[model samples]
Target: MALFSGNQKNTAQNVYTNMRTYLAQKDGAVHVVLINSFSQLANQVFKCDEKYTTEIDYVLNCMQREGYEILDIKFNSIPNQGMTGNRTGFNTLITYR
Candidate 1:
């Protein structure tokens, strides 16, 4: 809805920080699900519905920067044509080794 506002970035950073904390709490390697609600909002804002894809790319970069090994990322199937109610939602599953 709003152009990359400070609060938005902060929220993402906060989630990442929490993720880091969660990872630190674990004794061994971990598997995580990273949901990019920002990209979801972007889809709704721009009416493009491609936010999931873009967010996955961003997540890939983040993982690379953080040096986390990726197992897989779940993605939303494009809303079926002529139907909004049937929209399939998704989440990413990432594994760190």
Candidate 2:
């Protein structure tokens, strides 16, 4: 699971780089499960930096640029916990040749 928090741009770049290297050595599909919490309360609770959150479009574009086909994209709303409310989550399935 890829938890998108902190410095999102840097995190995405790092993840892309790692994935590129790994895919070069393997021959199979890659499924990336990305979870992003946009709730400020949740961010504070989880100690996630709120300055920037992962943008789904950016991530998708990055992978597509590397020739990875997006097989499926799914979204599930995370139920609000006691103190934290309004958090959203996304589940993506990516396949690479």
Candidate 3:
């Protein structure tokens, strides 16, 4: 499992590189949880500049090229207590033979 909180420091290239490294060490199902975008409150709370965001499709395509099959994609959200509100994200299930 991989979780990316959409840190402003993380670029799409960084994510892809990390995924490649992870895939190299495994040969089964992979679960990826990524913060698609952050809310205004989340941005302030997390001190994120929103300078970089990962393109879900782009990441998936890179994975597919590495021989992984896309199994499922799901949208998810988490409710926060006060100011941050709900955090929206996505889950991707993939498998490699």
- Give the number of the best model, judged by TM-score: 1
Candidate 3 yields a Cα-based lDDT of 0.50
Model 1: runs farther than 4 Å from truth? 24-30, 34-59, 76-90
Q: Where does candidate 2 have its weakest 10-residue lDDT segment?
A: 35-44
For model 3, how does the per-residue alpha-carbon lDDT over 1-97 read when each residue is reduced to its tens digit? 1245354235655767776755643457455544343333344365532332345556667777867676666554444533445454334344443
Local accuracy of candidate 2 as per-residue lDDT tens digits, 1-97? 2354545667666766655654442346555544343433444365543423354555668767866667777665455543445554434444444
| lDDT tens digits, residue span 1-72, model 1 | 345444555565556656666553334566666563424442444465454444455555665677666666
Clashing pairs in 1: none
TM-score of each: 0.47, 0.45, 0.45
Against the correct fold, how does model 1 do in TM-score? 0.47
TM-score (C-alpha, index-matched) for candidate 2? 0.45
**In candidate 3, which residue pairs clash?**
none
Q: What's the CA error at residue 93 for candidate 3, in Å?
A: 5.1
